[model samples]
Target: PQHAGISLLRVLLGFAVGAGAGLALGAAMGLSRRVDDHVRPLFTAIAQVPALAWIPLAMLLLGIGETLKIVVIAKAAFVPVAMNTSAGIANVPRALVEVGETFRFSPLQMLRHVVLPGAVPPIFTGLRYGLTHAWIALVSVELLASSEGLGYLLVWGRQMFWLDTVLVAMIVIGIIGFASDKLLAAVEARLQRWRTDGV
Candidate 1:
């Protein structure tokens, strides 16, 4: 239970960082073609590097501490979210945007009322993908470094030849990831329903 709690916290923290950064970057890219052209290539290149590739560098810079672990998870989380968000926002119907403009909506108001709602389904999809990937990265990081969390527990179990502990940790990670995805999916469904119902 203790390890489960720690793992859950790490997952949630990673989600928050990933989702926030992704949303900001996504919005920037979506709102400006110039910004997208300037940043998307770099973002794509960096994201192409596997999350595991960052472990060595994170350890060197952050010293295998909680910071390193979380940073890895966040990075893993951020890429998908940002990419998806950008795609979602950019795909928002031009007609809706024009209607917003016709109504004299400011840019921010237009985003809030038109663009965001239109983009939400894809945004949520990205967030779900991010959360799943982040969990995998976090577990790998914890198994290799750090001294707490379910991943660490699994590592410790391996050293002690305790397959049961390792099995338990793996199960817990899967369960948590599934639950998180379901929760997000429910939220997405609700939003879709609200949009469709014109509520």
Candidate 2:
């Protein structure tokens, strides 16, 4: 559980920063054509770069610290959330916007009443994908930089030829990832219920 806790903390911290940034950026881009026009190309280019690709440069900069791990994991979590959020907002029905406009809703009012509620589903989808990505990245970074973690266990087991250790760690990682996914899914379901019931 110690090893598992380390991995979970790493994932949560990194994913929170990445997903928060993604949500903010995506909201701005979705709300304003100018922001999208300027940012989308850069976002697209960075999105194409794999999370692992940043490790060497990050190591050079941060020198194998926890900050490097967080940055690497954040990179992994950012793209899907941003893209999904942008798509979600863009896909908010035009009719709803028209109604909001007809009602003379202020910008904030329109966002609160129409855009956010519509965008939330896709944002949650993004969170799911981001969690998965963060999990993958955490293990990857841990394999390289950590002395003790499930990923490090995989590495150590391989070196010691302890196949059972490797297998057990792999199983633990899988179970944790699966459980986290289900937790997020349940939260999403509850949010959907709240929206449906107008809570």
Candidate 3:
């Protein structure tokens, strides 16, 4: 139970940090065409590297500590969210944008009233992806370096030849990931209701 509670807290914290950074970067990528053109290639290249590849560097820079874990999880989360958000915003209907402009809407107003709502579905999709990625990365990081959390439990179990504990940790990770996915799916459905209701 103690391990379970700590693992749960770590997952929640990882999600919070990862999601916040991902949203900020994603929003920036989505909103700015110039920024997108400038940074997209770099972002793509960086993302192509495996998440575990960064673990050693993170350890070197941040040491075997909480920061390293958080940073890794955040990096894992950021890529998908940013990529998806950019695509979603860029794909927003030009017709709606034009309509907003015709009504003399300021850029901010246009974004808030027209672009945001149109982009929300994809944004949520990105967020869901980010969360999933973060969870995976969190487990990996914990397994590699951490002394606590569920990932640690798995590693410790393996070291002790305790298959039952390892199995339990794996199951718990799957359950949490599934729950997060479902929660995001529900939110996405709610946001997308306008599509069918014609709002």
Candidate 4:
């Protein structure tokens, strides 16, 4: 339980950092064609690199420590979040934007009343994917470098030849990930109360 808690905390922190940055950048890109044109190409290239691919360089730069894990996890989370957010904002129905403009809404009011409602669903989607990516990167880093945490739990199981332990760790990881995703889905559903779904 303690190890699981530790892993969860780290994943949450890194996810928050990466997802927040991505959300901001994506919102900016969606709001402005100029910003999108300038940043999208660079982000596209950077997103091509996998989280594990960044591990060695991160280790050299930040050492095999918490910072390294957080940075790698951040990379894993950022791409999906950024991409989804940009898409969400861009896809906000033309009619809705027109409605807001018709009301002569201020920029802040426009975002609050129009943009948020349309964009929130995909933003949550990005968050969900970001979280999953963070989990993967966290475990990978832990397996390679950590003294403890859920991923190290797997390492310990492997070293001790404890198949049951390994199986349990894997199960725990799955349950946690699934539960988190479901929680996000539920929140999305709540926030979009006018929409109905089979879920």
**Global lDDT scores for all candidate models:** 0.90, 0.90, 0.84, 0.91
Per-residue lDDT of 166-189 in model 3, one digit per residue for the tens? 999999888888998999899888
Candidate 2 local accuracy as lDDT? Answer: 0.90
lDDT (tens digit, per residue) of candidate 2 on 1-199: 8887888888899999989888888888888899999999999999999999999999999988889889998989899899999999989989989999999999999999888877788989998999899999999999999887788899999999999999999999999989989999998888677566965
Pick by TM-score: 2 or 4, better one? 4
Give the deviation of candidate 4 from the true structure as CA RMSD.
2.2
Q: Is candidate 3 or candidate 4 better by lDDT?
A: 4
The total of clashing pairs for model 3 equals 0
How many residue pairs clash in each candidate at the backbone level? 0, 0, 0, 0
Model 1, global lDDT:
0.90
Q: Which RMSD values do the candidates have, in order? A: 1.5, 1.7, 1.7, 2.2
TM-score per candidate: 0.94, 0.94, 0.91, 0.95
Expressed as tens digits, the lDDT of each residue in 80-161 for candidate 1 is 9999999999999999899999999998899898999899888998999999999999889888997889999988999999
Taking the tens digit of each residue's C-alpha lDDT, what string does model 4 give over 82-170?
99999999899999999999999999999988998889988999999999999999999999989989999999999999999899989
Candidate with top TM-score is: 4
